[model samples]
Every structure is written in structure tokens, then in C-alpha cells.
Target: MEERKARTVCCIGDVHGYISKLQSLWSNLESCIPRLDFDSALIIFLGDYCDRGPDTRLVIDFLVSLPFRYPRQKHVFLSGNHDFAFAAFLGAIPQPQDGSEFREGWKEYEMSEEREGWYREEGYQGMHLQGRRWAGKITVRFNTIKGTEYQGSIYDAEPTFKSYGVPHGSSDLLRAVPEEHKKFLTDLVWVHEEDNVCIETSDGVKTGRLIAVHAGLQKGKKVEEQLSSLKAKDTRIPKVEALSGRKSVWDIPEELTEPPTIVVSGHHGKLHIDGLRLIIDEGGGLENNPVAAIILPGLKIVRDTDPLVKQ
Candidate 1:
């Protein structure tokens, strides 16, 4: 059998709409990795591309432009919870399976609709759960574990709206995001699988499987069941645990007994690395922190501030 060449897989954590920082990070990544490896790298952006920061529109534009500029590199875009809401606000979320109406799932979350400020604007009767949550208003102020203060709502999507020249709850938001960008948001994947990647162990280099979701997989749920729901792009469920649930997705599923798949994610807002589970969102969409990424095989970490750092 022909030997499989060693390749690099780059996983980027939550971007949160910082154009300059993202650009800087990209420059650093390009500078650090060899040209051939950089060109052929499998780059997976772990989601949360919009919100919090001041350049959501520009960030999306840059993301959408990746394929054209780096044609040889493979890119996988995952859907972050905030990005899901942004899509919902723009009516770009994936449709329910089987062509069923989205409203069928509304009753489950209806109680919090008022609190979350589900869309009261025109054409809201046809909205989906994410659409409602994305457009909903709330009085809650969120303070992160690191003491970052987020005022107004959970998703903190106001900056995204403003980046596109609209207010947080304006109906004009649907018209604000460009058609290509809306398509970009709608096309985001819920999960990605990479087979036969190499990982370095204490003893030796070994082949491994990798599954990347925006958030970690639920601890107790059947792995197939979770993957089924995610692959189906089911929106009827009130919350997609893979996208937003924190504690639920923190651990690897116990039933994944054989083959030893590596589960990686972002959206937890904290960096965690334990054996096969990697959470890489160091920036956590915070203004002061640097966005981060993890290089495969060697498990090297690169940040927006210290891009050349490697193992």
C-alpha cells in the first residue's frame, strides 16, 4: 500500500466579526505554514462568524471570498448559534426536512417567545425557532466567565445588524444581508468528518478520525442519533444542542467505544483540551482576546497575537 502523505488540517475557532484580526490571523497562518502545506491544507472554521464585533458584513465577505483566492485549500464552514440566528433573521436558515412547516415546532418554545422577543414584525407568523430567537429582544445581560460584559441579549447580534446598516430588530435586516452572503449563511454545515488523519500519541503516531461540530456532541445522546438530527438539518427542535448547549456537549459520548473518534468544537467560550476532545475558542468573541486555531497531527496552537507559535 502507498503511504499516506502527512497533511495539515487547520481548525479556526469563533471569529465573531473582527476583520482586521481575522486578516492578521490569516496572514500569520500563511506565513507560518509551508506554501505547499498551506495551499493544500484543510481549513475548518468552527463558526460564530458574526456578532459582537464591528465587522460582521466584512467578515462574511472575507469568508465567502476564501475559495476564490485560495482555490486549492479545502474549507469547511460550520454553523455557530449566533450565525444560525443571523440566518433566521434573514430568512436564510435551512428548511425543515420533508417540506413541513416550521411553525409546527414553535409551540415548544412559545412560552419563552415573549421573553426572547420572537419576531413581532410583519411576516412573523411563518418564522422558524431560530428566526424568532434571532430577531427576539431580551433584557438579559450576559457576563462571561472571563468577566466580558454582554448587554441586551444572549446572542449579542446588534453589532452584526449595525454592520450591515440596520438596527437590531428592523425588518429591513432581511434585505440588508446580500444574496451571496445569505447563501453562505444558509449553506453552513452542522458537522464535518475527516477520516484517517494522523495524531501524535505519547507512544507513536496513529491514524485517527475527526468530527467537528460548532459545539461539542451531547454526552448521553446516541452518536448516530445526534448525527442524524444534525445531518437532517432539523430545526423543529427548540435548541440544537450541538450548536449552543454548553455542559451537554462538553464530554465525548460514552457509547463511542471503538475506533476512538476525536471530537472537536468551539462555542464553549473557553479553551479546553482533554485527550481526543478539543475546544478551541480562546477568543470567545471577546474584544480583548486573540482568536485561535489548532493545527492537526502536531497539535500546535496559533493565535492572532502569536501566530508563529508551534509545538
Candidate 2:
């Protein structure tokens, strides 16, 4: 019989469209996977795949194509605020066009690559997914106008995807997402349905302890310990609240307002807060926001440049 190999799940946090940073992290991952001889693996790519960086579409394409290369593992996508916006843009919802413009505004990363046989002007690349594409591929030419901004062009008339959330607009993104990734966003972004704190032993059980979440749970408030007190889904950390029955991360006022649970989220680049939380957005990529992920190879929870690696 073939050897039964153990599996590992790497729960990654916000990537923010940093292609270079992702490359560097992947370089490191190459060694981590084999050295341990771990079985199968899953990369939970916490979302916000676009914006604030250079190669937005490149990142999206790369993530979408992951399963092709590694048929043995799964690449899960979690919806962050930005990704949700991009999804809305794709569906033609009337949100801000700045994000769409930003994409339409830039050139593709491969545009400059010598491999491409064409030499089109950087300004030539067209909009994708309804004006959503890459920032690096083109430049933002801002022109303010009284009638409709940007020399009355209907394109600039729209606003960038609002950083903030709107009901119908936000949901649109989730609605039209690719089939496989749809559940990841729904599972994370929407509210949960939990009455008491419940710790679900992932299929492997070991991955459960990793407690990989887009944002860490309240500090000192181990999901295992505070399972019962968790009232809503929004504030609860990813895993604990996932199994719990809550509506959305927005549902829990206690977690969001006052006693906000300590989180290990990637939003705050250099996590600045109180309580027993740790920030894993370790300033990844050069000139790019850091890319952070937790590698649970066996019983250890490992991270990039993280002193928290279990000994």
C-alpha cells in the first residue's frame, strides 16, 4: 500500500496583490514543504487579491491557477474588504469606479516582459472584469471635470470601489465569484450560525489547533477556551466562529466594539492594538506590503519572519 502521508494546511492572510512578495514567500515555501515530508497541503489565501499594489490581475490569475499545478492540495480564497469590492466591480454594480479605473489605468505586468511578442503602448491595454485589472500595467491619469471628471469621459465618472461596504454592492461581488471560491468568501464574509462556541476538529484534527484565521481571535481568548461565550460571528476568529452560528463578522458588537477579540489579521500592516493579539503582516515583499501565512506542518504553527514558530 502507498504510504499514508500526513497533511498540512497553510492558512495565509491578506496578500494585497503584491506579486513580488508572493514570489519570495513561495520561494521559502518550496523548502518547507519537502523538508517535512508532510502529506497534502492547503493554502488558505485570505483575500483582498487586488488593489494598493502593482500586479492585481497577475495575482488573481496566479491564485486561480494554483490547483492546476498542485492537484494534491487546495488553494482556498477568503474574501477581504478589497476582494469583495473587486467582485462587485466585476458584476457591474454601481460602486466607485476608481478601483475599476485603477485597473483599466495600468499595464499588465507581462506588458513589459520581453517574452510577449507585442509592443503596444502602455495606455493601450483594455479594461477587464468591468474595468478591473492591474495597477502596474498602466498609470492613473486623473483629470477632474465638473460635468463628469476626466474630460467628461464616462469612465472616470464612476468612483473607485468604495473601501467601505454597501449592502447590494458588496453582495454582488460574492454573487458572481467563480464557483470554487464562492464558498470561501461566503464562509468567511457572511455571518455564522452558532448558538455556543464550538471547536470543529478539521477533517485532520491537527489542522484545527493551527486555528488559522484571516484575523486572529481575541487574545488570551482561545476559541477552545471561550467557545461558549462567543455570541456573534463577526468578532469571533475565523475557525471558532465558522462552526458557530453567527450571521456575519459585523454581527458581534462585543467583538467589533469594546471587547474586540485579539486578532492576527493582515489589514493593520504593523498590527497596532491592545490585548493578546499578534500581527502577522510582517512587511512582506520589497516596496510591497508583507505577505504573512501560517504553516502548520504537523503540530507546529510556523510563519514568515515570525518569532512565534513553535519550538
Candidate 3:
């Protein structure tokens, strides 16, 4: 049976460890609350919990403690690709040379059925992200003569992950991640695709649908069909005619042959679709960008909110 959910839900977007920002949001929410009363409330954290900001570790520590600290509160922390890699490193999977930060994030949150169960009910296998397989084709790839790629040849996979830039190449920071975590990350890069959350929410006085995602859905196919295409385990490159039925996250042919259901994604940071009512990603980890989140279970009745993380 699908687990029962609280009537009121608060959806948080990509929080790239902006400790101060998080604190600010938390404090503000207190004031934001008391404006309504429901049988219960669920606070859903749309993934992308770390990276691109200062104190990624600190941010994770704070977030992981919420469940235990709050008790009985309806909370769901979805796993972002980065969250998986960092947590795996902490658990020492695919063991990396350094596992300190990953360890910190891992230890920060308890691995409970409650946490994993949250996403399972959501119908996203993000929790098993570490177990996702990529034998056929890879959307993104990496080729650098850096630490891992000794062969030094062009290799294709997903983008691997985002580079925070500012203090690029933090060997100490990178190395702190355990080997297993590195492998998980490597695998994640090999199969990066458009990932997002589909939520159901309601505004104050009306009912509506909304999608909060990191990128926009391909123009051609409907959102539901496009989602089915992504769910494919055998992502074989479709023939041109067959491709007509598929959908891509970002970087799809602008001239879409099919129009899928609407997707609200955040990967490109800010892109939109009309029919889908695609909302732009409030830039996180980007300079001068406002931290953001999407509230749900209100009256507007949003269907999903997906936080996009780079491969």
C-alpha cells in the first residue's frame, strides 16, 4: 500500500551546502508556518544537497540530522547523483583514496527505511542510483589526463559531476572521498541523464500542476512518454523516425518532432516550457543566485519538483 502522507508539504530545491542560506530558510519557514493548519505536514527535500558552495560537509551534517532531531515529522530527503557519490565515498564503496568528507556526509544521516522509503513511494529509484547500470550508451563523457584517466584518451560517459570552479582541483577535497565513492561517481558520470522529482501539491485556493526540475523536457514528446523513454534500461540510439517518439532533458534537438508531457527541470538553471508550465531552477552554488524551494500540498496542487544534478 502507498504510505500515507501529511496534508501539508514543503519542497526545498537544490541546496548546495549554503549553510547560512539553509539556516536562513529554516528560520524563515517558522514564520511562514502558523499560516495554516493541517492534520500533518511533510517537508520534502528535493535533492542536490551538496556541491558548488562553501561547507558542503557542514550543510550535509545539518540536513542528515533533521529526521532524528525532529522526530515524527514528515520528512523525505531524496538522493541527488552528487549525494549518492558523496555518501558512497563516505561508506567507502568503490573506495577512494580519501573518504573524510564523504564519511562526514555518510555519518551525518542515518540509512533508514524511512529515508529510502520516501523516494520509493515517490516512484523514483534515486535511492538505488548507486546500483543503476549503464552498459549501452552514455549521455556524457570525460577525457582528462588527471588522476583517474591514465589511458588519457577520449572517453564518453555522463559529465561525471559539476566543477565548483572557484578553487578548482581540490585534490585534498577530492581525495577525501573514498574509492568506492569515486567508482560510484565514475559510474554515475557514465550514465548521467535528466533526473527530476514529480510532486503533487496544491496552492491556497485553487488546484493546479507544476514540475520543479533542473532542466526542461525535450520539446517533442509529452512529459509522460519522455519519462518512459528515460526509464528505458536499454537506451539504444533510436532511428530518426523512432527518435521521433523519444524525449531528451537538455541539449535535445530544438525542433522536436513530438511534444511530450511537460517536464519542469533545473539543470540548465533557468529554462521553461509553456504547456508543462516548466519553472526555472533557482540558481544554487551560482554567485548572486537566490536560494530556492517549491512549496506543495498547498491549493495549486503541483505534481512534481525535480532538482537536476550534473552527472
Candidate 4:
């Protein structure tokens, strides 16, 4: 048997679609960690690679090229809610197990479809709820404390569609996105687990298991059941709570009493560092914020705008 070496896990939060910010963040990560460790690091991107910003296409390109560029580093590309919707729009999402067509998931959300302004363009009649939702128009307005209007919908996926040279809600996006990029989107995992990882806490440094998902595990659901569904990539079930729910996924499930898994996520659009649960999405799909990451062992944070980079 091969002995496994301790890996430096670098968990990156949501990178909406800002390639420049991602590039700068990558540079900062490289600068902070030793070159050898960085080269062999286990990089976990906490999903949401598409939507909200410019250059979604470029962001996917960069993610797809990482394995080839850094052969030794292990990369985990998780499927964020946005990426899932993007994949659904391209007809790349996995099918439901009940032999139901992808369109079945759209029925429940149909009443809101008109209100949400779901994509009714070419081939949309056969798409999933997430696909339509991904391309839907904004039904409500968002404003910052300064009263500046946030320039997108709840999904904020228009930029993603436009980034691929297709208008929002257009089936032309099916061909607009490159094949490899589509594969990347389709291959994203719903959950990732790493055992024997070192975690930093007030108690002391200890080795524990870690789980990374886009949003989080549903509070009342069983961990194994949730893991089983996620592992199977079940799409038949309408409304994946892990991908979209907020308050429901906020608390860790009480049933996981065995080894106590440390859960981390990013879709909340906020940076929350709670005891064992860490939500690191600081960008919040905003134009002014920087992409962020939390390095393992010490849980040291490094952002795109880290002082090391003279930005």
C-alpha cells in the first residue's frame, strides 16, 4: 500500500466569474504558501464558478486547465447552484433516476416561472427548473446599504450566458459553450470528503474529517442519506436543499455523531467562520469584493487583495 502524505488543503470560496480576481488570488496563494507545498496542495474550490460577473467562460477554462497545468496537485471542482443551473441550461445535468424527463423538475416552479420570467426561448420547454431559473429574469430588486442597485437577478446568471456569447435564456448557449467546458460543468461533484485532515480550533490542533459542499447538508436530513443522494447525483428530486436552501442548511445535522465531520460551504454569499462550520464566500457575487480562500492547518486566510500583492 502506498503511504499518503499530509496535504496542504487550500479551500477557495465562490469565484463568481471574475478571472482577474481569481488570477490575483491564485498569485497570492502561491506567494503565501511555499512553492513545493503549493505545487502538491489539495485545492478545493467551493463551487459557484459561473454567474454574477464577467468572464465566466474564462473562469471555466482556467478550472479545466488546472489538472493539466499542475499535474501533482489534486483539484476538487464542486458544483455550485449557479454551475448546476448553467449545466442544466446546456442540458448537461444528470437525469432523474425515475426515468422522468429533465422537464419534470420545472412543473413545481411553474407558477413562479412567469413571475420569475423563466427562459422561454429555443428548447427551453424541455429544460429543467434550474436551467430555466438560471436564465430567468429578476423578479425583485436588490440594493446595497448605500442604496446602489445590485445589477442582477436572484441567480445573477445573465453574465454567465452572455460570457459564452449567448443571450440569456437562449438555447444557442448549448453550442456556445465549449465541449470540454461543458464536461467540466457536468463533472462537478455535489460533495467532497477528506479524512484525517488537520483542523485549527481554539481547543487545539487536531486531525479530523472534513466535508465540502456548495451550500450545506440539510439540517434535519440524515448525513448518510444526503451523502448517498449526492453521490448518486440524483436530479429527479426537485429542489436540492443543499444547493439552494439558506436557513435550513445553516446548522449541522445532529445525527452525525460518529467522528464529527467539519463542514464548509460557500453559496451563502457571506463569510461565516463558525466553530467547526466555515462559510467562506466573501465575494458574494459582487463587483467590488475580492475572491477569498482559507488555507488549512492554520486556517489562515488569503484574499485576492492580500497585502502581499501590490494591487
lDDT digits (tens) for residues 198-225 of candidate 1: 6666755666678999997887778998
Error of 1 at 166 (Å): 0.7
**Judged by lDDT relative to the true structure, which candidate is superior, 3 or 4?**
4
Q: Model 4: number of clashes?
A: 0
Runs of candidate 4 with Cα error greater than 4 angstroms are: 1-6, 139-153, 309-311
TM-score of each: 0.93, 0.44, 0.45, 0.92
lDDT of 1 at 60: 93
Full-model lDDT for every candidate: 0.83, 0.39, 0.38, 0.83
Write the number of the candidate with greater TM-score, choosing between 1 and 3: 1
Which residue runs does candidate 1 get wrong by more than 4 Å? 1-4, 141-152, 307-311
User: Between 1 and 2, whose TM-score is larger?
Assistant: 1
Kindly list the per-residue Cα lDDT of model 4 for residues 249-287, writing each as its tens digit.
987787753556778899887888877788989997788
For candidate 3, what is the TM-score? 0.45
**Which of the two candidates, 2 or 4, achieves a greater lDDT against the reference?**
4
- By TM-score, the better pick of 2 and 3 is 3
